[model samples]
Target: MYRPLLRLLPALLVMLASASVLAEEVQVAVAANFTAPMKLIAADFEKDTGHKTVLSFGATGKFYAQITNGAPFDVFLAADTETPAKLEKEGAAVSGSSFTYATGRLVLWSAKPGVVDDKGAALLRGEFKHLAIAAPKLAPYGAAAIETMTKVGLLPSLEPKLVQGESIGQTFSMIASGNAELGFVALSQVFEDGKIKSGSAWVVPTNLHSPIRQDAVLLTRAKNNQAAVQLVAYLKTEKAKNVIRSFGYEP
Candidate 1:
């Protein structure tokens, strides 16, 4: 019996060693629009690979500037493909490492019921005093929102009522907190399980704005990090895609 137990101990030790060897922790900077889906994907990634992730959520433009200034994130999930492409050109990210992870949709949302409608006619009614939007210079969702309003001929008419947030997450908070009665926000912020969670929303038509192609890249700081590589690949997996879809993003 002592000999049998000794034999099993060797195998157990090897298994523990393997876990220790594979358990790498990656630091990820993610776009605010992707916050909800990323939380789910990170949990699944860790469970599936025995690795771990530390996540920071913010606007892509700010993250870009931070990475350029030597912020130590291992990976970046940006809200626009162009941002990652620019990072690669600037040598801030691993060459040839960027890929589209999801395409986002913009929505006009209100925390109060009946405050928004499918056609977005509320903007024309002038009933609302404040409208929140992410800053166009700092967030792709905000740029798209501006484009959407311009297409619908509401840009000039609605500019006076606009309130800006640093990021889409902040914009969502503004609307959710009643600081803005209605706003343009990422669909992922308000959507869950294939429907809007609590707010009244008008999913802006895709034709109204350029497609928001979100991309992820392995940062230069993580060029040789196996965990970062695994994470970027994981974002392309079916499991990750499902999570993105659950938040109403196109994966």
Candidate 2:
């Protein structure tokens, strides 16, 4: 009886080892504007998959620079379609592993309610002294902001009032702190899906500018990583799609 029990013990130990392997953590590089939703999604992902996420949120441009210089990232969630495409083309991202995971919408937001109207043209009118927007070079939302301004015919007129932040997160802080009366931030910062927050905001029309296609790509370095595969599978599910939509992004 003792010898038979010992024989079964080896199989049980092997099962335990397999479970530990499935619980490994994956590291991810994501865009700063996704911070809130990523936090929520990561929470759900861990619960569902028995895996962990080590997320780094920042400007896509900076993330790209790091990955190009050997940043140890297993996955990249970029703010723009172009960044992911570039990485794939350059061989830093696994070919055919890139896809649009979410669509971004920009918003003109103010800490004080009624300061901006539905059209948000008031932002260009400069009723406020300073307007905080992310650097167009670093953030897709910032590029959208610039294009929106140009389309509204305010680009030339409102140049002086513009104050660029390093990333959309900084832009949100500037407006939230009232350091800038109004700013261009991701719609997620001002709204949760259909729920609008306190403050006047214009959900910048997607047709007003180039579509902000947020793309996700598995890094070439993660080609053989099971954790990374788990993350990609988890993120493409209905559960992840709902989480992304809850943050005012189009899933």
- lDDT scores in order: 0.93, 0.88
Number of the predicted model whose lDDT against the real structure is largest: 1
As a whole number from 0 to 100, the lDDT of residue 72 in candidate 2 is 94
Q: Residue by residue across 74-125, what tens digits does model 2's lDDT show?
A: 9999999999999999999999998888898888888898898998768656
State the local distance difference test value for candidate 2. Answer: 0.88
**What is the Cα-based TM-score of model 2?**
0.93
Q: Report the Cα RMSD per candidate.
A: 1.3, 2.3
Model 2, poorest ten-residue lDDT window?
Answer: 189-198
Residue 93: error of model 2 in Å? 0.5
Per-residue lDDT for 157-248 in model 1, tens only? 89999999999999999999999999999999888878988879999989999999999999988988888999999999998998888899
* Angstrom error at residue 60, model 1: 0.5
